[model samples]
Target: MKKFLLVFPFLSLFFYAGAQNKNLTMQDAMLNARTTLAPENLSQIQFVYGTEQYVYAKRSGNDVTWLTGDFKNKEEKNLLTLVELNQKLKAAGRTELKAMPVVQFNQGADWILNIQGEKVAYNPAKGSFTTLIDAATAAKGNVEQSKAGYTAYLDHFNLFVANVADAKQVTQDGSSDIVYASSVHRDEFGIAKGTFWSNSGKVLAFYRMDQSMVADYPIIDWTSIPAKNVNIKYPMAGQKSHHVTVGVYNAVTGTVVYLKTGEPAEQYLTNIAWSPDDKYIYIAVLNRGQNHMKLDQYDAVSGNFVKTLFEEKDEKYVEPLVPMLFLKNDPSKFIWQSNRDGWNHLYLYDVKGKLLKQLTKGAWEVLEVKGFDQKGDNLFYVSTEESPITRNLYVLNVKAAKSRRLTSGFAVHTTQVSTSGQTVIDNYSTPEDPRTILLSEVASGHSKTLLQAKNPLADYNTKASEIFTIKSAGGDPLYCSLYKPVGYDAGKKYPVVVYWYGGSHAQLILNSWNAGAGDYWFRYMAEQGYVVFVMDTHGSDNRGKAFEQSMFRRVGDVQMQDMMTGVDYLKALPYVDADRMGLFGWSFGGFNTVDFMLNHPGVFKAAVAGGPVINWNLYEVMYTERYMDTPQENPEGFAATDLTQKIGNLKGKLLLIHGMQDPVVLQQNTVSLVKSAVDKGVQVDYMIYPGHEHNVLGKDRAHLYQKVTDYFMQNLK
Candidate 1:
């Protein structure tokens, strides 16, 4: 590894020599960030469905006005106001809305506005509205709507289908142990929503999870009068997992058929897709070991296994998160994302699983697949080709095997392509610029700025921050960010706090606004006369597969090595106080905090770990096994990382915080560690948030941060 660090040349030095204004309060940093302190943007912004026109909400006080602009003419007008919308709804004999409902363009010029529990289709130009579905009466949990006028949802563990006039129950034998139309596998493998609607929208496929064989884990709700215990089915590592299967429901005939996914019954069915003709359903079937995956096709109507389209196997693990993206003009062809060559890129495949060619190739990962043009020849996507810290837009010509970058700038961009593929709405941000939305022509790449948000922290006396890179032990460039103390002096030493989420699927340092430190808490720490540092180690996201796979068997080993490298770098600096260093992280990061405190004893003066995973054996089956494997299979690996066994190694002041109702990383983890600490005669500080799950959100977040800040202040400051 290189001994010298390489600072990014393009990054503007945030150290302002001039006198600044007010400092950030905890409320302004934590509670009011997304509200009053947030950067302004085109609210509810998107291209009108199937049209080149785009619309966004503009709020002024109690009223919200929607503005629509044409892509060709660049003319924007007030499409409708809250009063006008309410007047139209009242005229149509529906209940009036006090505030503007979240609107989406569905059927041509009509607005599908979600008002309370009903999806109302309103046409402001025609002064008419139609109630599509009343969610309160008909649909509830995991609701999914289709263009074919069918709504599928789960009510009390049972699956139901609702039409215009009536609702039909799809499953009758659903109970607490038998769930229907719900996301299964603990939401791993990129499963966000429960139901999958076919292209024709006539068929709905959902998951049926039978966790009766699994044991129930109790979480005490302290908010209750007498502290009620809520029993949840949590499958720990090496334990008996829940059995899951897919159920296909026919809306036209009101029939249900279970997919004949003959298996060990404990496998994972992820990345579900449907044929355009709605005849076949494709699922990526992964074994419980999570090393082998088979992309299989099944007949939708018959519920019979058709064929295995393809298979992927890895020595460590093969994670398929994105579903097949079939071409719009050609249903027989699709795009698949894989990291087979050690980098996440796109590949072209026929329906028969024939590899046509690799469409994209490079070191950077393809972040998202936007969409294809009207001809399906050009594909739009977001990638880290320019830099891992920045996300930019790129358009690939499938036929020519060529690609070009559409959006420019050293910032993170999120884009929405118009249906015609002629234009794109690009939303991006940088440290100096809060946010900027651009309307760009896909063909020529000509762009026009729609909104350039004013800096929200203009009035605040924020300190200096910089995003740079330090070499890892293996010669890889690890990204790091540093926030200096307010009124920093080079002659005096200042206490330092290191923060990071050095885990899979997360990147803490970025090129966006506030350098990807979302809350003002970092600035608040800087205000308290302490330097803050964050680093995205090898295990973090957006890097290639090899960088993450390094943590396959041993989770915290590589990340700790890189983190210590960062610490060494900081100690060399004259302004950083090596003896007064501290650490902070939550969730996986919380795990890191404890790992560093124990494994590398006396390295940190103080640390705060929130919702930490104390024992890998106690963590959930899906996530823990993916990285650490089963405890029974790799007992030594689990034993090495388990913090409960190493409580005696802890040297400095450590504060452990947990949510009493945290289901993800259960409170049992902390209890187990505390029990071990007691046995070892070690003293540690602990705090708990009652009735909170996984994270302490809302107003409670400020309290949690305050507790963390106070602990660090009392110990390290």
Candidate 2:
């Protein structure tokens, strides 16, 4: 703990740390954070679901161990020891799983653990101990397994289906305007878990959603006791949208079906794959001006419509996020992902759609697939081909079609693979290495570290960043980073703060590790002395698909002409103060810190903006019609990123944080920009949070970065 700050010339800087003598606090910048300054990350390497035969566990000050391995029988064991599964959950009175629970193995290696709220089923080579669901009969977010031993969850609001000795309920109309199973369009394309199973889970498929023809939106609940509106069904943007159907069920014929997926049941039937001979399923649909798409293929025990194998239109939309990958033992080819060749490559197709070749082309942008290498003849992905802010790891030989680069590390990797792909694990990071993990050997990339982590800010006052590259006004280049204010003194001008996020899937500096250093309150406002920068404009996020469709339909014109080429590299930084500069962001970096401080007025004097989107006809309709193509067809690109039609062209000192339950850019977008800055008398500075949503997260995000470091040290120090 080296802290310092003590300035005192009759000091009066209000809870100061300003001209950084050093020290830190807003609860040491949000509840004593800086704990090891971030690097201990091994969040995933488990592999027992669909087998690569892994296990992993490792703990020391009390010894935990598990281990397991087996990349094609290089074998290694241990397997059951988290203090002997907490001494068999303290001899079954349960509750001791505490830290290592996600080890889930099933096809014979018997693992399934879940502990505290119970769902046991252990086996470990016959140490036998079955309970599998019974935390007083399970219910909250229920359960959901299925490697044939079925589990499918949810009870209050029906839809069940247990296994370790029968349970089955399967929806009795849970009503409250029909839900059953959960997650729907609101969760957008990735569609987080709403069940799905098949290929041996013996039919499950889920997601029902009916939202009784939309329209509710009240949400008042100020911790109640007279404050209680709470309606929430909000479909907004041209409204009335929720219908989603997918059902199926069966669990050995308890019966259910549903997927006809036809009609205007409010379009968007998303990715949802299946077809490993579980009598077919697939879906991809989309149509609701989400510019056509039609991957279809249904009939899982008579849900019908088994046809349309290919289609993908897009005047400005057709999104279809991932779900084709089949080919693990060839159920008749698969692999699809597309940006329709503007970049996001990979096409292979089969099962009657024909195209069979296009496995990976480039401008760069594959991003993730990580599977098949166990006799499927190679294929493992993760790319930007090397820099869309970095992420590497390749392989692709699905019949000598070519592809190679298995991580020559600059960082941002992220592997796992193993089931005869011949080892992988990886887990990377890097603008200066803060997470290692190795394990390697996918055909000689060769390695073995298996865990590194330990930096969590090693003591503090952090700051050493530099990763360069600028040139944007259409000449491209971008990627920036900078840091400059940690005990610096280039004749001291200081101030500066930047931290943007120029949208389109976002990418603020990367070569992984410290490059994703994350804006820890701009590293606690560069330990409170400022000058922090971070760039990647021109529609960030893994560059490809013509660099994220270059702000199509003008979303803040190439993000303020690439943040005015980062304030002309911070007014040619001579220790950079440039009129005390400042800027930060939240939702779309609070709509680019108020659209680049009102379209570059004075190059930012002060700024904050959490949860901002000041109107694109109030956001959603599958992401503002795939990048602003609807305010009745880009009315001048939604009247130029519509910041409430440029909120009186805002000048400076702007704050406006929001989240009085922001269901995605909506606290009526800063109460309609403070009622259009009180009908243009103009003067803003707000903060809301209450029961937050769309962010201002936990520990109230350290009182939202101590009210954004006391409004940029009272308006840019």
Candidate 3:
């Protein structure tokens, strides 16, 4: 691998950077982002990316039906009857159904079944029933089914493969030091799944994490009648980290082969992609230093290294979270996504490690791939090509490398493509439109509305949010948004609360419906006559690698610089009260929230930081090292970013909140921060959620948010 440098346009030297349509701002972002109820659907739902065609269950008043054609020539098909599912569930001792049960089909929708509860299957034609597995409320490990009718799951520390008839233990070791069939690297590097089935379903590839050498941190469970101590393998920065390997299991042979993605054994193996032929596996192997990465190909059969397709290195870091996609017809040629040129785009490469061509290039990043056509002639993708704030679909000819904008309207569109690439299922919303799920025809660019979700908060009086652009310390433009009081009086200054999470890989603001997501508390606070300001600034996501890495070797510095620039702008506004400004954040935003209260003392009279990382030294290796390097490598940087050093500078009613059982940020961070504050004679307020983790969620979330609002009102007001 060779090292290289690409100067980011718009002056990498300087950078800076919200809004809500009737949507949620960071203050209330996604405060109601979750849905507790499931929508009724047909046997299955499928969408064609970049097109207005899709297959889904359509409901018309009292009539519910399924369609299997384009938007224009849609054909209704009777897949199953209510009588059939009720009969099947009744035989299985389930209560008689109300309407029709939500049934899921196989990948190809060849069969319909109830994946939940008893896992019952129905043969609509024959009116027969098949119970795949017994009713299970939940299991110790996650249970996932393969297209080939095999179920793979984790049984505590071991991995298990099973079917309706029989089961087999894939891993035998039960020691807590080792884990099989589990998400590793604290779920970073986009590694969310452990078990991956081959294309033809002959093998199972799973992650084996050995944390025997890592440190065991004790988490207290205080809710029990008698407190319980839970020990977890927590690898801190520069510490002896856990090792991971990929093991492939052949179901027919009952043989296992581990990939030889050799390393210091502590390196990160991410973005596992299987070749179309199922003969090879590709891994984006990142070194422990995190500055260098190689897209390595390995033989699935022998676990032998086939070749290093390419490598990427950067002075700050090279994060490879996406895997390569092999062409459907041409296995020898594959498409790889990279940000080497300062923007994420697509590049075509051959199996021989030759760069065939650059498919897409520009200042925009491809947000997601909606999949290719059945023939692989066209590729559909959602991108920031339209505007960084919005997501729209585009279709590209794989061979010609030419792309056409599929979506024209100004809105955020999360698209899905059909097998033939002729249909697109567009789930989009605007500030004016709460949600509009459409079926778009790829060739004609015509769309038919599938569902227009009415405003969920129509009855509630929510003040519309406004977006603004502010310049950062680096002279780059930053987007921000705020919600004013329901009945605003410009003659009077309103207390303003600035909430943000300016960390890597997460962009808080967007141009979607409901301004992407909002906080209900923000609306409540607005109704009570306060302004809520939130910004997605530099050192965060979407812009480019350089924009995010501006804080390299320093965690909370640049983020705050940009944030304060925005705050200063807000302070100048006639309606925003400068003296009553407050700040709030969670996780990375939490880390910086404390950083701001202490580093920039008096900026916020009151503040709340939940689940914060007190010091980089205490954070996990992969993430911390990527941004801050090892504590030993950058002692001064660590010293500058650590909250312990700035505790004495704290000059506000600072409230530090934490989940006692937080594995990511850990309760130790708040404990350490509080102790340092005491040692330095600094006043600090604190709270702990007995059984919560990194985030205070569920019912407790409302309580936590209310507490934050109360703290700011008591102190800032």
Candidate 3: Cα lDDT at 662 = 92
Residue 525 Cα positional deviation in candidate 2, in Å, after optimal superposition? 18
Q: How high is each candidate's TM-score?
A: 0.98, 0.32, 0.90
Q: Estimate, for each residue in 235-327, the C-alpha lDDT of model 3 and write its tens digit.
A: 999899999999998877878999998878989989998988889998999998988999999999999999998899998898887889988
Q: The CA-based lDDT of model 1 is what?
A: 0.89
Model 3 CA deviation exceeding 4 Å by range: 1-70, 73-81, 87-100, 120-140, 163-165
lDDT of 2 by residue, 1-717 (tens): 111222223212122222334445566555555443455754345666445566676666656666767444564677776767888767866557656665566335567766666766777556667776677566557467777777877767788888778788888888767888877787777777788888788789888989898877776768878888777776655566788899898888789989888889878888788877878888889987787889989888899997998898866776777888788877888888888878878888888888878888867888788878768888888887766666888889977679998776666777777666777777887655667876677776767675787655555665446666777766777777776666777898989888787887667777665567554565677767888888878777777666676787787788887788778768876888789888887888788778778777777888988888877777776777777755776677777776766778777889888878777677887788888888888898898888988877667788888888888899888
Q: Which candidate is the best by lDDT?
A: 1
Ranking by lDDT: 1, 3, 2
Local distance difference test scores for all models: 0.89, 0.75, 0.77
Each candidate: RMSD to true structure? 1.6, 24.5, 6.1
